[model samples]
Target: AQTVTQSQPEMSVQEAETVTLSCTYDTSESDYYLFWYKQPPSRQMILVIRQEAYKQQNATENRFSVNFQKAAKSFSLKISDSQLGDAAMYFCAYRNINNAGNMLTFGGGTRLMVKP
Candidate 1:
């Protein structure tokens, strides 16, 4: 079984500042994919970043980056130079490579609020 946890239910960051959202996961499988998704008020699930279990380097996309500690099973998302557009509900998800259905197991989610 695999599980993702976002200890913080809500987070707030000042505009132009940096914020890091915590995410911890437990999985028995060695090969899997970890993802950070953002859903705004419009309800569109957007992929913020992704990391492969076998990859040693952390994944980064523009202002978003992940601190992927495979040994510790921690995949925290760091948003640098936060902007108003970054405010959204963020979810940490896991997908096992062996699962044919391609279903994703998601965390409770953390709602991010940006302050001007």
Candidate 2:
């Protein structure tokens, strides 16, 4: 079974500063998808970024990017120039490459607190 792990249970960042969240996973499949999701106080799950295992280049969206290490099965998210709105619970999710219609298996989640 594939599993996702987030070493940090909670994290804090000053407004306008950057922070990186650590995540690692164990998967037997060579091709799969890794994702970072953000859940705010509202509890809505939002996709922060996604990286395909087959892609060598990392994925970036706005102020978010990932360091995907397929060999090590490590996928981390970096939040650059963070803002107050960035405060949320960040989760690492895994999806099978072959199962397109299946839902994602998520990590416990890392709660991000933004201080002004």
Candidate 3:
């Protein structure tokens, strides 16, 4: 069984600064994908970034990046140049690469508060 964990229940970042959200997971499978999704007050899950377990290089998208520690089973999300729009509930998710259903296991979620 795979499980995602977000220890931080809430986080606050100043506009133009950077913030990193902590996440860890326990999984027996070696092949899987890690993802960070953001849900605003609208409640829509938006993909922020993803990292494949086999990839040595971390995945990056714009101001979003991930620190993937495969051996430690840790995947953390870093948001650079944070903006007010970045305020949302951030969730860490996992999915088995070989699974056709592609079911996602998500963490409890961290609510981000951006300050001007």
Q: Number of the top candidate by TM-score?
A: 1
Q: Please list the C-alpha lDDT of all candidates, in the order they appear.
A: 0.96, 0.92, 0.95
In model 2, the runs with Cα more than 4 Å from the true position are: none
Q: In model 1, where do residues sit more than 4 Å from their true spots?
A: none
Per-candidate alpha-carbon RMSD to the true structure: 0.6, 0.9, 0.7
Estimate the TM-score of every prediction.
Answer: 0.98, 0.96, 0.97
Q: After superposition, how far is residue 94 of candidate 3 from its true place, in Å?
A: 0.5
Mind giving the per-residue lDDT tens digits that candidate 1 earns over 37-81?
Answer: 999999999998999999999999999999999889999999999
lDDT of 2 by residue, 8-97 (tens): 999999988889999999888999999999999999888889999999999999899999988999999999888899999999999999
By lDDT, the best candidate is 1
The per-residue C-alpha lDDT of model 1 at residue 72 equals 92
Question: Candidate 3 — which residues are off by over 4 angstroms?
Answer: none
Model 2 RMSD in angstroms: 0.9
Clashing pairs in 3: none
lDDT: which is higher, 1 or 3?
Answer: 1
Model 2 clash pairs are none
